[model samples]
Target: MATDSLPSAFTLFESIQPGPVYRIPSLLYLNSHQVFLAFAEKRTSSSDVDAKILVLRRGKFQDGSVEWDETVELSTAVKSGYRSMNPCPVYERLKQVVYLFFNCVEDGVNECSQVLWGRNAARLCYVTSQDAGLTWGQVTDLTESVIGEQVQHWGTFSVSPGHGIQRACGTLIVPAYAYIIRYRCCLIPPGFFTKPRTFYLYSEDGGERWSVGEPLSRCGTGESEMAEIAVSYGNRVLYCNARAVAGPLSCRRPSRVEAVSLEPGRFEIVHPARQLPESDSGCQGSVLSFSCPASDQFSWLLYTHPVGSGKDRWWRHCRNRTNLAVYLNRRPLEQRHWEGPWVVQSGPSGYSDLAYLDQASTFACLHECGDRQPNERIDFRLFSIDDVLRNIEQRGRGVATSLKHRQ
Candidate 1:
């Protein structure tokens, strides 16, 4: 218990009144240059409609500490009535270029209207940077290029608001979800239910040419992130995990949607005997697949989310956002469950982005934390793999344990 005083998590931005508020953290680590980039949405309020601009910070490690430069606001030149949402993938090392993929929508266009009326005011837009995020190139429109004939049928679309990944074969992939509305008889679908699915956008010629992959699931999947995984026998697979929603008049249960793809965009969704629990918060969670040299395996999947259970699973806003936990699994294709949660944050926590500092043998997370609310400021927590699996023994038995009982 005495070791609890040691620092495992720290704050990057503190909350203040009548000033800037930050949310939606995105972290990118450039291993070649040992640089870290953090991106977030600088909002006027905690509401979804208050997101005005995307802000970024650049930093480098020195003596086991990272010092960040001055905060820079990444401006979007959309029309006065449009706003940018979900800034993702700030580091593109393949072509020696950086990209920020997000969606621009007209102001006052909410999700309910778009979902109910089958109308979308959103456009897939992006910007590039050659020399890091110091200067951004002109914005490009990807809505018509990636989604040509299906553009109209897409009720609305947005990125996952996290770091995107590049496949081994020189393909830039960004995870996203859109509403696929079909008009049968009235304004809403049959029995007031709607269709939503997860998809990915890929670029082959380094942002010169782009195309959209097929939907990952049939419907009801949204806000997904994809990570490339390597097997022991020199085989690679793409894994996508999405947030599952069970609305009223819907028989679907609350769970996490999981799937895999050997070919980009062509996924075989896994329907296991049991379903992964959706975080009590119901917000987006972060997952990263990385190789573990210490462990005698190819790689492991690391995930972060708020862990808890409540009586009412319909609405998550009323649930406590405490006990932000991290889980690890080696054989994702065969295993039905992951290991210990290793409770990291015991207080109000929200959407987080993680970066594996391999050389330092630690990982970093940028998340939302506060005393009474989760929107006060986005925090950066530093931890190691051993700390995550403190006293849990591994015999290939499927059970998730935790170190601290703070939750």
Candidate 2:
């Protein structure tokens, strides 16, 4: 572990309208010479809130210096209707194109989750850029075929997946989950029972086309999200999941985080998963890429959010708090457990959209802060993996030394 503190990178807040509103699942891409970030932004108005994509670029962030580029809007009224959110971008090196995927909903009322409601709701569309972020190709619909027959009735349906990665074999593996509302009474809206199932889509020929693969896990009664790790120990592919189980109607279930190998695409109960040790009310968990350092045999870092608590029915006030947990592979994962939900960034401005880059030497985290005020903006920060690892090691050593002294 390095004794010095991790350096903070440059942060930028997009300038939208009355309220700077955005959604989760923003995309970050690195194109040899520059870095590109695409996120959805919504501006409230008298009639409806207009939504568009805000693109930002910079050469690098060392020495607190940056050649910040102007923000660009990717959506138009004629093409995108009035609502758009959850922009995910993937850089296709072979094709020399960057593909930006997002969900388009009608008006401002339907969230990606509202696809469960019988409404002309969310669908996945994408735009391509040949010259970095300077220009974009035609906006094309990508979800129609993948979700064709599954989304027939309006009741409610959503297949908003998280970060996507290209496999070593040049296959694009997109981790997604489908949530459908099943039953509802007068007091509670129907289609509120979220049945989340994990699945993947692959693109054999670059990003030109994709094939829907088998469901990663059985359709469980809960809200679930999936993430994929490209390289693990022994070069194995691993899949991570965070499931929000529905507790009794009077109370909510505690969310749990778990992982499994991609060969089987099933979650094995390796550890006793639990929500972060804060107020379970407004907490959501995400499993960032996992890595095992060359020096250590059993050390891995799991980046996630440690949102403390919330009161609103939907956890509207839930803020994103960056957290990392260190695990020791002393025994098999199914036998060993997790330790320390260490705080990385804790505040109203928590880090979201986390990605591991530069061979796990650097980590990039993007998050939005502030209330829905004009000042609300998205921030991108890069941290040294060494610094994070050192913190975890020091904590581990402290615990070990204490145990030895006591014994």
Candidate 3:
């Protein structure tokens, strides 16, 4: 399926959804049908509570290029005036089903107020589709059942705005985060939000049923994503990449948190995790595990983040959202062992999602990028695996050399 021609970037969405800003882009590749689905939250502004719609774009690969169909904007009819957000699509190859996970919060209720008032404003919901993105089922609210007794005490939480992992042994896990409101106090004004953490829900039998898993030990964990890489026969490693959002006063570092697991539901935070040498804007990034034929290896990890060079210009680089590079992790289990971060986009680029097409050795990136600013539009770019490797070889010292090694 390799082609000599590279696919031109295509605009999936702009400021046409009644406002002038779009955020949180997610991309998923469906090997079952050769379809790529892009998900995002449509908003009038950057406010978390201002999100209005959950938008999706579906397309199939033809002649080594993308052929996108019509956009499918969705709004689940909830009982209250809640806005849908964080459209995460997970494809189950065993059952051939696509489960779309999202959250909804009351229209006027923002995230901070929800935690400060000791309230749980967000609801975990999902919808299913059999024929890729052609049609979808009704929204199935899982807050009460999945979160169960903790819904009242647990503060508002939401799924990672990207793909989930279905392990090689048929376990489906969706990464999520929540602010622990039970620890909030009237005098403290939601002290628990200073240390948000990432957790996950797992389903053993496809997606028919689900249950919450143990939260990662690292605090300040924000949006998260997970992928399974098999290390040996009948044994696999679960790698989780998360955004660690820490306030200025908090001592918890805001570097990307990486965790590994041998069991199904438990994750242990690996210290000295591989930190992306990118700007410290606390932006959401994506990670994928794919087969690299040239290496004769088990699996390789691909990560995306905003890469910058200078210390004084960190804020400027973070603001411009330029140089979104892709890093490769050849050694999966080693702590902070990463290499070859080749810059894929030299211009304005921000929050991105990656999906590797195994048949073509090509990676599809759906990211927020523009001519001068990052959020002007969400564009899709395709890169061959060989191109990235070549960039790393020619550059000699890989981009991973610039990564900050924190203790």
The candidate that wins on lDDT is 3
Tens-digit lDDT track of model 3 for 183-209? 655577664544567888889999988
Q: Which parts of model 3 are misplaced by more than 4 Å?
A: 1-7, 16-20, 76-80, 182-186, 192-194, 250-253, 278-281, 294-297, 309-320, 398-407
Clashes of 3: 0
Off by over 4 Å in 1: 1-7, 76-79, 186-193, 249-253, 272-275, 279-281, 294-297, 309-318, 391-407
lDDT of each: 0.72, 0.50, 0.76
Pairs with steric clashes in candidate 3: none
Instruction: Report the error of model 2 at residue 309, Å.
Output: 7.9
TM-score of each: 0.88, 0.74, 0.89
Which lDDT tens digits does candidate 1 get at residues 235-280? 8888887876655554434667778888866787654213356642
Question: CA shift at 222, candidate 2, in angstroms?
Answer: 7.7
